[model samples]
Target: MNFNEVISNARDSLTVKRVYGDPYEKDGLTVIPAASVRGGAGGGSGHDEKGQEGGGGGFGVNARPAGAYVIKDGDVSWRPALDVNRLIAATGLAVIVYLISRPRMARARAKSSESPSES
Candidate 1:
């Protein structure tokens, strides 16, 4: 298949219906869960000096719960979903950043403290 066709297929698979999911009813209330979808696709073909052909392609898709649409008694409301896994990952990244920067920040502080000042 061509690159465009592959990209189109990826998009088709991540349609609104696939992301938001089907609505279901429970206790006279309808809930439609929603999700955030992300995807990328790329392909390339090249020829070498020896007249050899090379081709490569890559694609990725990620879907995560965003929220849900709740309808009850003719009223509608939105309820958001939280991903603890993402939260933990973010926290870990923050700690790593702080650890990497702490020494630099300390050195800057020390340098400022040692600088001469006029009374």
Candidate 2:
């Protein structure tokens, strides 16, 4: 296959149908699972003085569950998927922010608690 062909194939895989799975009806409700999809492709070509030519390409795709659309009784609701990794990262960030601000917060509290000196 050629470089262009490989890239095209990679792009083709990232379709709406792939991102959102087929809707299935259960208990009079339609559930459509949604996902986040990403893809990348890279290619390179080289020609040597010995009249040798070489070309190579690679493509990769990744998909992660993002959420789902629940349709029931003519009403639609979105249910988000939970990512443990993201939650952990967020928690770590919060802790770091708190630790960095603790000193400033303590200083403010101390200043407020100090008795006003008689003018």
Please name the candidate that would achieve the greatest TM-score relative to the true structure: 2
lDDT of 1 by residue, 16-115 (tens): 8867889999999999999999888888878999999877676788888999999999999999998999999999999999999999999999888884
Instruction: For candidate 2, write residues 18-116 as lDDT tens digits.
Output: 799999998999999999998899898999999999999989899999999999999999999999999999999999999999999999998888888
Off by over 4 Å in 1: 89-119
- The positional error of residue 90 in candidate 2, measured at the CA in angstroms, is 0.4
Cα deviation of 109, candidate 2, in Å: 5.5
Best by lDDT: 2
For model 2, what is the alpha-carbon lDDT of residue 18? 75
RMSD of 2: 2.8
Model 2: pairs clashing at backbone N, Cα or C within 3 Å: none
